[model samples]
Target: MTPDAGSALAGLTGADSVAHWTQRYGHALMDTFGAPQRVLVRGEGPYVWDADGTRYLDLLGGIAVNSLGHAHPTLTAAISAQLGTLGHISNFFASPTQIALAERLLDLAGAPEGSRVFLTNSGTEANEAAFKMARRNTGLDESGNGVRRTRVLALEGGFHGRSMGALALTSKAAYREPFEPLPGGVEFLPFGDADALRAAFADGGGATVAAVVLEPIQGEAGVRPLPPGYLALARELTAAHGALLVLDEVQTGMGRTGTWLAHQHPHLGGGIVPDVVTLAKGLGGGFPVGAVVAYGERAATLLGRGQHGTTFGGNPVASAAALATIGVIDRDGLLAHVTDLGAWWRQQVAALGHPLVAEVRGEGLLIAVELTAPVAADVAARALAAGFVVNPCTPTTLRMAPPYVLTREQAATFTDFLAALPHDLGEATP
Candidate 1:
């Protein structure tokens, strides 16, 4: 090897470690996510080690993707065994695991007998599929003639995804402005404002809208949940005008919020089902898999045979990984465990009397700490320095979506970690 290259390699294998890797990353990788917090090298249940061998509690859980935790034996075995048997196939063929995974998702969603599913590789693709389905289905009537219902409504502070179509549905301006001339026929409304939704329908001539998409709980927007009874009003409004109610449960489904779906939570007043639900994130437990589940006749039949397809959507390996994730969540009774642990963590964190902590809000493993000061980023940095990883969703909000396997001891340790932070957490970096 060349002299400089040899020295860099020696540094990577020696004390410099992630610093050298970080410098190389800045030169070679895109700046989409800015600098990564650390160069993670290894992980176990609720813990990850950086290149320096410093272990962290991993409370962010890969932004809610590691549902079963790092290097989970069940999940790894499922994926590996499936890969060995039949790795991948195009949409022209189907695998038993793929079909079973879809059936399982429908069962967990509590969908009716006629419900159907369309699988994708990520949450963005899942939202895109749902978006296309809404347009294709709502543009035609029972007899398949042309219709004027083409408009779509989404909530402010809602984050659907980052693809062109899903980006249009996402509410953040910064994420949208860079890619202007986005798909039209979409309207943004104040979240949880039932009056605004009703007025929009009335002003748009009632039947001009195709769908209303929403996140049961806004994950990227600091785990902000829908206000009480708001979803019920959304369901009623959409049903009355024949507009589809699409619930983007990408980050809240698959037992993340102590239930199969966050809408099924007792406080949300169960039984208010939506027409479409998009899921991903924790569904595959770190393996890439997404699904768009449609309930009832209208939404289920939206996309016919040839309307939408993906090459690697339901590959056997991904399906196996998802099935294993669901099985573990059920077999281990993680739903109830998450529910009780969330409550306990919230109570303990709030009782810390930390000046920076304003409040803790959210359900199950999806929790957020609203800061009294705009020091969320500083707090996150300090937390990381102390060997715990947390995410700052906004300048004033710190969010955590830890794995379901997280124990009470680990949860309690995080509380103590925060309690030990100094009153002033450096100046808030942008």
Candidate 2:
């Protein structure tokens, strides 16, 4: 199909589009998120054309899920070939791609020999599986106090996922309050605070805690990278106590942040290897897939054959997509490209000199701009009208996770537009 095939609604609709989505689809579909910024119709590379034919540079990369950019010939052909050959089969049976992807992920994370993997369909499911593995490994659950363990530790502003099991581990009140009566015994500590983290585990009866779950770099709350030595400290404390360290890499994994695993960074995450590593975004290069990479004894011993199962977890099509994505990332040397370009982009953005622009920070393609003014949502809208697309994480923060394949020219253009943001305010973006 031509790229135009994807723009089914472009040029043919406008005023009724938003209203139709609200009146017809809002009730029909779940209202988990509010109305979208625009009805995006089609995309190629960093450019997306909305229903109105307004082209936008997709700085969000579908929330860091599209690492190879959009519709690269290799990714498209790989998915098509796999779909044509063999799509999905029952989990009771396995395929080559499934096993290969799992092995590849372990190798990428630098897991020592004997590591294992569990596959899922979304980041939340991956975390759920990891949490379950932690519990099962402790030989508890399905029983009273002694049978089940309480006190799962999470970091403030850290987002793992949104399912019940994952939700219990998340510390956000807004995301957790509406759905109360959740599993209890979960504790929260300030993020990037080594002392607070040390204290939390210590207070949790330290050695008795089931596991410590946290994102190496908090993504959804606006690309918050952990301070240096924090992760290493977590590793040390978890070791001192016998608690499992679960690193939620759902956002920072799959080379979104320059390294295959953000934890490979020398300072923020560095060489510290957590007990459990969860990944999803950018795993399938825009397709739906998630995984938990557990090293050595932690992987295969999580559950027995009858303990867990999913209909589409290890399907061939998604696995093939993941394998292909990983292949493209490696063959193209995108990891180094990400690091160099990210540094350049961040440095250039910092030169904007807008007070609204307070700071620029992030690892690779995943970047966040803190503005002095609380007008992030407005700025995002303005950016869209200005023919670029960005996201407002907070009133004072702009989040940009453009694809790894982005060029220096694209980065320069973005810097210009960002510098003009203050002027665009009070007026329409264009």
TM-score of each: 0.94, 0.91
Instruction: Residues 1-430, candidate 1: write the lDDT tens digits.
Output: 3237555433234665778668768988999989878887778999998777688999999999999999999999999999999999888999999999999998888898789998899999999998997787465656877657888999999898889999999989999999988999889999889889889878545688889998889989898988888889889888888888899999998888899889999765376888999999999999999999999776888888888889999999999999999999999999999999998999999999998788999999999999887888888988999888999999889999999999999999889988887776633434
Q: List the residue pairs that clash in candidate 2.
A: 265-270, 356-371, 356-372
What local distance difference test score does each model get? 0.88, 0.82
Candidate 2 lDDT, 1-430, residue by residue in tens: 3335444444537554545545555666677687666767678987887665668888888989888888878888988999999998888789999999988888898997778888999999998888787676462545733433456788888787788888988888999998898877678888778878877766557756777887877888888998888888888887776678889999998888888899987746768878889999899999999998887675556667788778899689899889999999999999999999999999988887875688998898889998766778888887888877788886678899889899999878878887776553534323
| Clashes (candidate 1) | 0
Name the weakest run of 10 consecutive residues (lDDT summed) in model 1.
Answer: 2-11
User: Which ten contiguous residues of candidate 2 have the minimum total lDDT?
Assistant: 1-10
